[model samples]
Each structure stands twice: as structure tokens, then as C-alpha cells.
Target: MISYCVFDAYGTLFDVHSAASKFQRILGNKQESVSALWRQKQLEYTWLRSLMGRYVSFDQVTADALQYSLQVHGFQEDSSKVNLLEAYKKLDCYEDVQSCLNQLRANNVATAILSNGTLPSLKTLVENANVAHLFDQLISVSEVEVYKPHPSAYDLVTRKAQIPKEKVAFISSNCWDAIGAANFGFQVFWLNRNENVPDVLPGKFTTIYNLNQLLDKVVQPS
Candidate 1:
């Protein structure tokens, strides 16, 4: 049985694009592109920094990514960046998150968040969303000074929870993160909310459309 259900925070439990969506009036038709580039660059920076052994908090990486995205789209307003960054601290949790988390708790499965987000950001996000009570822990990659897709980051879960990798059900909306957890020997589930094609990665994971499907896969029949 899977004793713990470990989740990826951004884009999985919370909507990463919601920050940009909040400023849609200012962004106009560029909203979607800006959000996409910001998310893409954010992930790229984490991977690059991990490999280069230059670790920085996820907050800084997020700011840098947002700046790059805004500059690329010819958006020079300092207030736009400030407002968006502030908006990020309170990102909207996905519609399915609450129901899924409640069900997991009812089923006696322990829950946690293992993400690239820092501890303060994660705490603010869950508290803002009012789902802070549902999680047993909110883990940050900062504990290991690295980000996802790195073996050490995944190890944090096993170490902190005192659960073996095989007994954990790791879920991520990001294909790379799912792959990384799977490679680390967890029973991985890919929450493919956008119906996008899978990444051409070496690790193996089961794909599900939403969090509801996760209960069926991981919860043992009683």
C-alpha cells in the first residue's frame, strides 16, 4: 500500500498561470505567452542552477524568470512585475485539489508537498488557499540545496517521512518531475491536466487526467 501521497506544488495543486491571469487586462493578448515563457524559464533555471552547483531559493528563480519573460514581451513596467510577484504568493489552488486531498485524508493516507517552492512560499500558498490543514508536511527542495529532477531532492521525501520509496505515491503535473520521482523508485503518477504529450524521458510513470483518478490508482481496495 502507498502510505504517503507526495505532491508537486506548482501546476499540480496550484495554478501557476493564475498570477498572469490576474493581470490579463494589462497583459491583453500576451497573457498566455508570458505565463508559458515564465514557467518554462523557471524550470530551466532550476535545472541549470542544480547542474552548475549554484543553488538559489525558488523565489529568486521565479522573479528572474518573470523578469526575463516580461522583457522578452517588451513589457518594461516595474509595477507589472511587482504586482505579478505579489500575486504569486497567493496562487489559486486547482478545483480538484481540495476534494482529492480530503479523500486522501479520509482514506488514512499521509500527504505532503515536495516542490521547488521555498518553505515560506509553500506555507503562504496553502494557507491562502485554506488547504493548509490537509497536508502533513510541506517540503522544499531548499533542504537539499537543489531542485527537482535531482536524485537528492527526491531523497528528501524518504528521509523526512521515514517511508520507503516504494511505499510512496509521487504525483506531479510536470512530466519532468514525474519522471524524476519515478526514476528514484516511487510509484509515480503524472497529473496531465493539459492533455499534453509526454516528455521523452527515461523514467516510467502512470498518467492520469486529474487528481480524482489518483485515489483509484493508489488507494487500496478495502
Candidate 2:
């Protein structure tokens, strides 16, 4: 069994869909496609801008994405939408997360979140989730001036936890995360709660639907 578990914050742990959910209340059904597109573009900008050596914070990227998604989706100009989406950092965790994290604590496995978000955003999530104490640490990818899939951000886990990559179980709701961590030689886990397409890439990994499944798979012996 792995001794440490690393998680992605926004989409993986905290309900990243909250941004969309909040928008639905403001713009109704029309907001769905916009929010989704914003999220996609946000990720794209973060990756592309990174490659161009034009470093920007995730919050900036998010605003850039919102602008692009709005223009593409033909939405009216509203700067508030970006701020509204930013409000997602205040979102809570999935219903199952608290109990599931507690289970890992009982097993003495180290748990933490590795995100492209800023330190302030991660702090808000940990506090809103009321599980800050449950984690061994909270790391922002900005520490390396690059995001996940870069390996350096993931390597940050080692600085504090002081463990081998194989001993670390990487859990991500994002397929890209699975592919990246897998390629980096860590034991990856796909927390496929969204039921999206799986990563075709290969690596040392396990795929599970829910956190409770770990009871039989990791916590308890066969």
C-alpha cells in the first residue's frame, strides 16, 4: 500500500463544477456551455502560456479563459462573471470526501492536495472543507512556476513528506493528471467520479470510482 496520497484540488477534491453551478443561478441554463468552455479554456491557457514562458497565476488564467469562452460562446460582456467564478475557491468538498479522508487518517496514510491554484485558493478550500488538519501538507504548483504534469510540482510532495514516488498514491479526477503522474513513475489513481473518458496513456496506476472503495483495496487485506 502507498504511504502517501496526493490529490488535485479543484476538479479532484473540491467540486470545481461549483463555478458553473453558481452561474446557473445567475444566467440559468445559458451559463452551462459558457462555464464549461471557460474551464476548458482556462486549462488550455495555463498550459500554453506556460510553454511560451509567459507565467501567469491560475486566477489570471481563469479570467483569460472566461473572456475567451464568453466571446466564443456569444455571451454578453460581464466582468462580474469572472469574479463569480473566482468565488468557487470558497466552495466545499464533495459529501463523501470528509469521511473518506478520515478513513485515510485512520490508516495513517498521508493525504494532501496538489493544485495549479494559488496558495490562497488552496487555503480557502482546506478551510471550507474543514479538513485542513487532515492533510499532511498543502502545496501550490506555483512553487515551481509551473503546474502539474511538470513533475516538479509533484516532486514538491517529496520535499515535505520525504518519501519515494512509488510510495505516493496520486489521486486525480483529471485524466491529464493520471497521465502526467503515471509518466512521472508515481503510483497513480484516477478518482473517476465524473465518468469522463479515461486517460489512454500508461503508467503505474489504479482506477476507482469512489473513495470508499479504498477500504477493500487499500485499507483492508484481501
Candidate 3:
């Protein structure tokens, strides 16, 4: 039985691509590519920084990724970068987020957001989406000066909640994240919204198409 439900904030609860989507007027046909590269670079930078023992806030990493995307795509305007970054601060939550969280809360499940995000950005994101009150805690890897997939990053949950890893259900849209949590001993759920093939990682995790399935999986027995 799971006592706490921990979720990844960026792609799990919020739509990270929505930042670039908001600038469709300028990006036109380039929006998807831009968003993809930005996200790819963002994750790369996090892992790179973590390994190098050089830590920076997610905000800085996000800005750096956006800048790289803009440059690669030939978007020379600083205003374009500013607009995307500003839009990112208030990323729209996924459609199923509120309902799923509400159901979990109604069931008396302890809920938290465990992310690579900085605390301020996480707070602003949930608050802007009007779902701030739904979470019991908004946890950030920034607290440990590292990013996800690191053992220390996963340890934050155990430290804060005082729950055994076996009794926590960790959810993430990213396969690596789910793998990391599972390796750390949480019963992990991967929200496979993109229908991508599962990674060849060693840890076990359940994959679901949407939050509705996720809610059913976590709240009900296997």
C-alpha cells in the first residue's frame, strides 16, 4: 500500500512545451523543434552539471536551454527568449492534474511534487495553475544542489515524508526519472503520455497512458 504519492512537476503535472507553444506566432513551423531541442538540452545540462559537481538553479538551466534553442533556430531577437522564459514561469498544468490530485487528496493520500525545479519556480507554477493548495509539499532537487536520477535527489522524499520507500508511489513522465525512483525503492509509475518505448533500465515501473489510469493504478491494488 502506498502512503505517499510523489510526482515529477515539469512534464508530469505541467506542460513544459507550453512555453514554446505560447510563441507560435513567432516560431510558426519551428515551434515543435524548438521546444524539443530546448527540453533535450535542458535535461543534458542538468546531468552534465550534476556530474561535474557544478550546480545551478533550474531557472538558469532553463534559460540556457532556451537560449541555445533560439540560437540554433536563428531566432536572433532577445525578446523572443524573454517571452519564452516568462511564459515558462507559469506553465499550464496538464488537463488531468487537478482532478487526479483532488482524487488523491480526497482519498487521504499524502501528495508532493519532487522535481529538478527550484522552489520559487515550482511554487509559481502550481500557484499560477491554481492548484497550489492540492499538494502537501513542493519539493525541489535544488535543496540538495543536484538534479534527479541521483540517489540524493530521491532521498529528499524519504527525509521529508518519513515514509518507507516501498510505501511511496513515485510518478514521472520521464522514463529515466521513473527508473531512478524505482531503483531507489519506490513503487514507480511512468506516465507514458507520448507512447514512447520504455528504456532498457533495470528498475521496474508500471506505464500508464494518462492520469486517469495512473489514479486507478495508484489508488487500487495491482
TM-score of each: 0.98, 0.92, 0.97
**lDDT (0 to 1) per candidate:** 0.95, 0.78, 0.92
Candidate 1 local lDDT, 1-222, one digit each (tens): 898999999999999999999999989999999999999999999999999999999999999999999999999859999999999999999999999999999999999999999999999999999999999999999999999999999999999999899999999999999999999999999999999999998998999999999999988788
> Residue 208, candidate 2: how far off, in angstroms?
0.5
Summarize candidate 3's per-residue lDDT along 97-158 as a digit string, tens digits.
Answer: 98999998888788999999999999999989999999999899998998989999999999
Total clashing residue pairs per candidate?
A: 0, 0, 0
**What tens-digit string does per-residue lDDT give for candidate 2 at 1-222?**
688878888777787667666666555676777767878888888788778878788877877787777778666658656556667677758787888889887888888888899988788878877988888788888888887677787888887688888788888888888888888877878888877778676665677888776555556552
Q: After superposing candidate 3 on the true structure, give the runs of residues whose Cα lies further than 4 Å from its correct spot.
A: 220-222
- Candidate achieving higher TM-score, 2 or 3: 3
User: TM-score of model 3 relative to the true fold?
Assistant: 0.97
Report how far off residue 35 is in candidate 3 (Å): 0.6
Query: Candidate 3 clashing pairs?
Result: none
Ranking by lDDT: 1, 3, 2
lDDT of 1: 0.95
TM-score (C-alpha) between model 2 and the true structure: 0.92
- Report the poorest 10 consecutive residues by lDDT, candidate 1: 213-222
User: Highest TM-score: which candidate?
Assistant: 1
